[model samples]
Target: MGGLRRAALVLVLPAALLLSGCVATPQEGITNSSSPSELIPAPASGAPTTSAPLETAQTSNKAPVYWIGRSNDNAFLYREFRDVPDQDNPVTRALRVMMSQTPLDPDFFTPWQNPKKLATSISGENVITVDVSADAFNSNVDAAMAERAIQQLVYTATAAAASAGLIDSGQQVQVVILVDGHTDYVAFNHVRLGAPTSRSAGLVAPVWIIDPQEGDSVGDGSVKISGRSTAQGGKLHWEILKVDADNAKTAYLNGTTTASTNAVQPGLFTLSANLGPGRYEVRVSQVDASDSAKELFQDTRGFTVK
Candidate 1:
């Protein structure tokens, strides 16, 4: 909190919705059977061809369609870092460390999904609120999971704000997350942890690497962008945005599905996109399945196809 001034408050969210059965993932990129193979081909250098419907588009014809990058970079980050934040910044350094170990669930992340949900503020005596969702305490996520989640907010926020930093470190950080907001049913169960709290994970890296391993150049056909997540849980959404300029540099689309629970299990998703030939930024977000804060991690990698 020394070098930088704290922000008043900020919020962020995930970009996803519920799915019926299990979400299908393409595997042309990764090794998981659950994921689908992405179809992202290299854009070709040529003039636009406005051909009439040769053979009406088919329902099953998987193709890679290229488009333009509507917006650049993460909108949430743009707001927090670029926009005017309160003098007391409450999300910095340490928080990134905790998230590296265990990513927050995208389902609960509110900022992007819900702009109003504020995680912390600098106006008052550094008020901190932690919201828990229904799936916050899944069978697999036990004592360690709960402990880490709390610590992440505490360490990260305190490090960002000044007053919050003065607050008692040993005292528990107050949180007000929902148990089951999505479902009509609600069950509140206490998540107990071992006596001595373990130290949060060391500075963790949230970057993911996505690549089009499948033979490039599927001209207006199904291609693939394969890569790996630091861990798992977040669904795999894709975007193929193609930016048309004097330079055929940027253009692509995107697709994704969380790899948690039945709706979006830990796996892959196959999508269809078309590109002529150009540069692309394949952005993949890895949000936890339970954390109220979504977009725990995002990987925007560059790729080229023949």
Candidate 2:
């Protein structure tokens, strides 16, 4: 995640219409380009390995939005969203970081085929529309999962927006899904929409990679926890909490324990502060600077170190 990652081709799906933010336009059916001259980022951004930082802005007293698709990104949301003057929303920042992380690869794409990446933007409305590139469809994601992936993005952004506490209660934080500037189920081959073509949850392999799931058992050992939380025993990071009473009281736990690293997975975490005979509490919270505690998605299992 430190270095730049490689780029991929687009994944076009004729069967699955608008993935999420992509709305169906009257003319093209789906698109992020509101104008003909809009310059959509080549999804490559060159090749980003880590998560991309999202642009945050102060709340605006504007009307609610119904769609956040290609047209929306190019027309309304591009420059409108900004960071709060001096405030720092860690949650929002974390969302931005998660975005730049390794982008999803294309599905069912051929070696010779060139796929396009989908880029989205949000402005006037809370919606972030995406122009499903041919590359995305070609990525070979599951017909059913494609829509889910798109929807998850919408949910993530909305969660961030809600945390920012911007906009009004009248205007709901919503994210519309779109595909290739249109909102119709089609394949990379440009076939008409039909029955659910998605074989299962997705066309691409759903990965739950934990960079360092297991670490050294000895306290002197280099304990580095990682791997996909979605995987079995994936949430091994929070199993043990070291507590050293002699150490800083403000610290969360004892010994040298790694903090929870939310690497684009879903889950929660709790701490164990039961200082025993020789054990002492060091750090109190899971948020630490070592693992860059921004936003970690992990399964939460409460435990107290006996």
Candidate 3:
């Protein structure tokens, strides 16, 4: 994945012109705030216990896995679904993927390297605690990058725990990091690791292209582009650009689509685009109403039209 690269073009249109009367909102689940009362319930006292081989517990299940990717203006974390090995503790498995530094998308990446061992357990308070080997602190990034790295772990663990039925869906979860079982260590020599961290979609990539995944081929003339976002009022902008294979040149399609999402939680947006047989790149973005050129969140995925 290290050697993969591709070019992208972002054309920002004036918010007033593009957003006028284009508010088609969709219904979505409400995202619950992280609270002690909302934590995953621990096993009941005196429950019967059974032992199973770790090998047997390694069954495959598809769940969302997030990675860091770059847009024309910003670098943000986004998610994609992948098969993970089932286990008694799904949060640990999720964290393992985060630390693995391998993403299915070549454009995405992780800063994790060396001494990647990690252990996770949910506390009675519903706070998940992650203990990492000393080697986890090997990175030398700045403060902002360090913060994003921590959130990546938090988001992965919380999402995994929710998927495993350990926590309720849409409820936020918190995480605490301990280096070698000690909370005194600092991450990347910048941010303190002694405090508990919670999920913040604001810190993550705001837009996700869930359908027509990277390099997919669609026979239908129309393709549905869908994903989640945290933009204000759940409003997002999308455009399709036809890419020329010979020179990598791109031409804008007919018109841009505006999709709406739930404001309180991450909202789902779906839009359909009709195109002739060709190769194209679909770009979705959330532009700051105050500054059209300042893109708060954006993502692009290439697919084939057959």
Candidate 4:
């Protein structure tokens, strides 16, 4: 919630409305299952056809699917990934995963209707166009909720497209929303929906924990920490904290890493930390390279080791 405070102030619903437990339409394809393995079948074509290798698609084509979650006493959108099938339209499949209402983590949720409800496509120059159903805007929510809902779609679509290589990382992908195939439409009767929206970390969780996800238990001596960031020069700082009943304390494992050598695209970093059996919190932060004190973004997740 570091860099998101101002945006939240502008977009957050009234405290009473926020506390009223306004749940958005459940994601479309999610089920009460353990892994994405249960969500959908592999592509029918059954062959690797993209520029990316088939073996990589079969095993490593994991794409991020963004959803809403809570941390640091605030509600912000976060990301998780699913193994995308190796097919002609991997980007579309990834978008389907994002549009699906099911969250990999029980703690996450989304306010947007399923992407399947809208006809989604990637056009020239990495522009994603979503033709939304008129019925998709029937939510009785406030302006803040409506705004977040649109952002939910924008972030998810662009993220999915980037993961599938349809769009470049660190580059802004434009998302155009159409209602009943018309660009001029109102969303949720509150927010206008005619312009192209771009992905911004200020609108979504800028930091994410890519491994040892919430409620996970690791037997290995060390936990691998990794995630995507939009910070300057792709530089990131991290800290490991141990949580006890009375207080949460920082552990000795703390350091910094670069997500990328240049900051043109989303930067990724991985670190390994050793810990004994305990409950711990891992925090990732984006700081100004010139002034470390000027923290731009932060995110944290809890996990257990045994």
What would the TM-scores of all predictions be?
Answer: 0.26, 0.31, 0.69, 0.59
On a 0 to 1 TM-score scale, where does candidate 2 land against the true structure?
0.31
Q: After superposition, how far is residue 133 of candidate 1 from its true place, in Å?
A: 51
Stretches of candidate 2 off by over 4 Å are: 1-100, 103-119, 123-125, 163-171, 185-238, 241-270, 274-306
Q: Give the per-residue lDDT digits (tens) of candidate 2, residues 1-306.
A: 101001111233431333433444444332222111222222111221122122234344221111111221121111112232222232233233333332121111111123244443443444433344545445454333334333334444453444344323235444433445655545432232222121111111112222211121223223333322212112223334343454322333333233223444232123333333332222111222234343232221111222
The per-model lDDT (C-alpha) reads 0.31, 0.29, 0.58, 0.57
Give the alpha carbon lDDT tens digit for every residue of 193-256 in model 1: 1111221222122223324421233334455655433234435455565534443544345455
Q: Write the per-residue lDDT of candidate 4 for residues 225-250, one digit (tens) a residue.
A: 77765432456789999988776676
Question: Positional deviation of 117 in candidate 2, in angstroms?
Answer: 5.2
- Stronger candidate by lDDT (2 vs 4): 4
Which runs in model 1 stand beyond 4 Å of their true positions?
1-207, 213-220, 246-252, 260-272, 288-294
Give lDDT: candidate 1, residue 209.
33
Model 3 over residues 86-127: C-alpha lDDT tens digits? 553566666766676477667788776646567767653446
**Candidate 4 vs. truth: CA RMSD?**
15.6
Which clashing pairs does model 3 show? none
Candidate 3: misplaced stretches above 4 Å?
1-60, 86-88, 114-116, 170-172, 217-219, 244-249, 252-254, 261-266, 275-278, 287-296
lDDT of 4: 0.57
